[model samples]
Target: MGLDAFAAACCAIPVLASLLAVRFAYVLCRSGLPPTRPRAAGLRCLIVLGSGGHTAEMMNIITELQKDRFTPRYYVAALTDSMSLQKAQVYEKSLIQGEGEKIIKNAQFMQIYRSREVGQSYITSIATTLLAVLHALWLIIRIRPQVIFCNGPGTCIPLCASAFLLKVLGLGWSSIFYIESIARVKKLSLSGLLLYKLRISDQFFVQWTQLQQKYPRAQYAGRLM
Candidate 1:
């Protein structure tokens, strides 16, 4: 084929793939009832705890969850982030002491590699994101939790993508709950934008009413923190 024809064919392939992907995602979203409504106790919870503000916001959301109902909660964070782990430990301790032993005993901390370290180059970030996605895929396969939760964070992108793929393939029943960061007043952060655009999150939550108004598909239940 001519050069122009070859280029057109290549472009057509990706266009077709994109259309198929969007169709598959839409089918997955409409396949069954919503995933957030837990029907039984001991629902395994996998939470992605991003560093800094993301961690604090997720902690607040976790507090709203019934500690007794969601058993064996797993917190996933980036390997380079020690602060988020520390905060998670404190929260786990509180859950144990206040709610029961399940929180302390069953709660696990999963540290995946950072998708983008401080001052990393764009190429390096892309490489690390691929690695993070692999790790996230394996982690999700291993745990196969009923639900996965995360707020706005770069790290959550890979995990959310993995979960979305899993749902699309019917490989797992894991639902993704992505909450936009409270700091995002005008618009969604990078991670939130990615998840929302791809429709990866089964439940997309926003902290501000304006955000919800902007993105009608997202749910807004007031301030999480």
Candidate 2:
């Protein structure tokens, strides 16, 4: 076979495998994802961790979480870029006016990062990841919240890691990753890969049907805007 033909054959196998896995995952999620509603009553705190548009959605969920019987204690924000922080600030008044959900912004060097592109972004990302882990560990130690909710930024890496550790030690609260999109081009996203690897979030609420096929573990939540 010619060189081009050989390359096509090699690529074809992985593509076919990916397709099969997608099909298998679709069948799995068609049954539905694991139950995510807080099993216990009186959830002391619900940390809404996201900055941009995702943060808006998180805020909505935070509202949902607060509506429950418990009466929330804090709304910890580890914001990403400045824009996200601005978006978060807009909700500051709403957060305070209610049952005293403290809107504390704890953005360490690692929790917030920006660069033009990939390349060394990975190296900085690692630093960012380490800092986030330390921040998470420290927060979990200090706040001792019943749950750490995530609408990922690079900041989430450490928090998720620390929360997972806490759970193992039998001292941690619940950690959740609010998966906004199921079919994002993974090869193009550092955060997405991190979410997949950490895998700590209790449930992944997928917003698309095609995505459910790609991520078999994800629970299809239907379409998102």
Candidate 3:
């Protein structure tokens, strides 16, 4: 290539990169802002379920949600968490009994790889976490949910991160709502802390006023459980 052409290409490369970076930053900042769009019906919702009490608390919240507005609901749990999945299924069955067959048809269940198993060493967890993140990216891309609801759960980090990536790229706008586990009175759980620190969740809620004071961004909802 000619010297002038080579020089121009090199200059354009940095300019293009800088422009892309600016665009990315702008998108990320805008994503955290309160959405101005008017509420619409039939919005897609994705709910992440954790084990035991986390699942129970989330189930209670789900029961209170306007089912008609959040159509085509998707529930995701860790692959090894059979109990959580079962609980979700039972909850859906109850909805069907109370509502109708339409409720069952609108709901879907999915399982994702756990980022780290209980008591697993951090050294080994790195690999598992990467795998989990990749799986989460695929799931997020496929689902492209408008609303994501997750309580404190390690499984949620990867999914939320993937959703945030989509938002930054301007590919999707997933409004993430995270609620800290009710058991955490004075502090946030690891998942909640990460989501808060990274500004990934559009809305973060805590059950205790003290916790909300400590984490200024967290909204105190007064014992959601």
Number of the top-ranking candidate, with lDDT as the measure: 3
For model 3, the local distance difference test gives: 0.89
- Write model 1 residue lDDT over 1-225, tens digit each, in one string: 699999999999998888778868665656335645647668788989887888988898888898777778899899988899889888888755456545477789989987888899998788888888899899888888887888887778887787767776668777778888889998999889988887777788898999999999898978767
Best to worst by TM-score, what's the order?
3, 1, 2
Let me know the TM-score candidate 1 reaches against the reference structure: 0.82
Model 2 residue 69 lDDT score: 45
- Model 1 misplaced stretches (Cα beyond 4 Å): 1-27, 35-39, 98-103
Worst 10 residues of 1 by lDDT: 29-38
* Better-scoring candidate (TM-score), 1 or 2: 1
Tell me the lDDT of model 1 at 87: 91
Q: Under the 3 Å rule for N, CA and C atoms, how many clashes does model 2 have?
A: 1
- Select the stronger candidate by lDDT from 2 and 3: 3
Q: Can you tell me which runs of candidate 2 are displaced by over 4 Å?
A: 1-41, 66-70, 79-92, 95-128, 175-177, 182-189
For residues 1-225, could you state the per-residue lDDT of candidate 2 as single tens digits? 699999999999999888766754543343223435646665555454555556666655655544454344455555335554555445654654554655534221123322222355676676755665666688667666655565555555566566656655547555454565333533313555566555656666666666567777666766444
The Cα local distance difference test for each model comes to: 0.82, 0.54, 0.89
70, model 1: CA deviation in Å? Answer: 1.4
- The true-versus-predicted C-alpha distance at residue 86 of model 2, in Å, is 5.2
In candidate 1, which residue pairs get closer than 3 Å at backbone N, Cα or C atoms, i.e. clash?
none
- Candidate 3 lDDT over 77-122, as tens digits, reads 9999989878877888787655654448888999999999999999
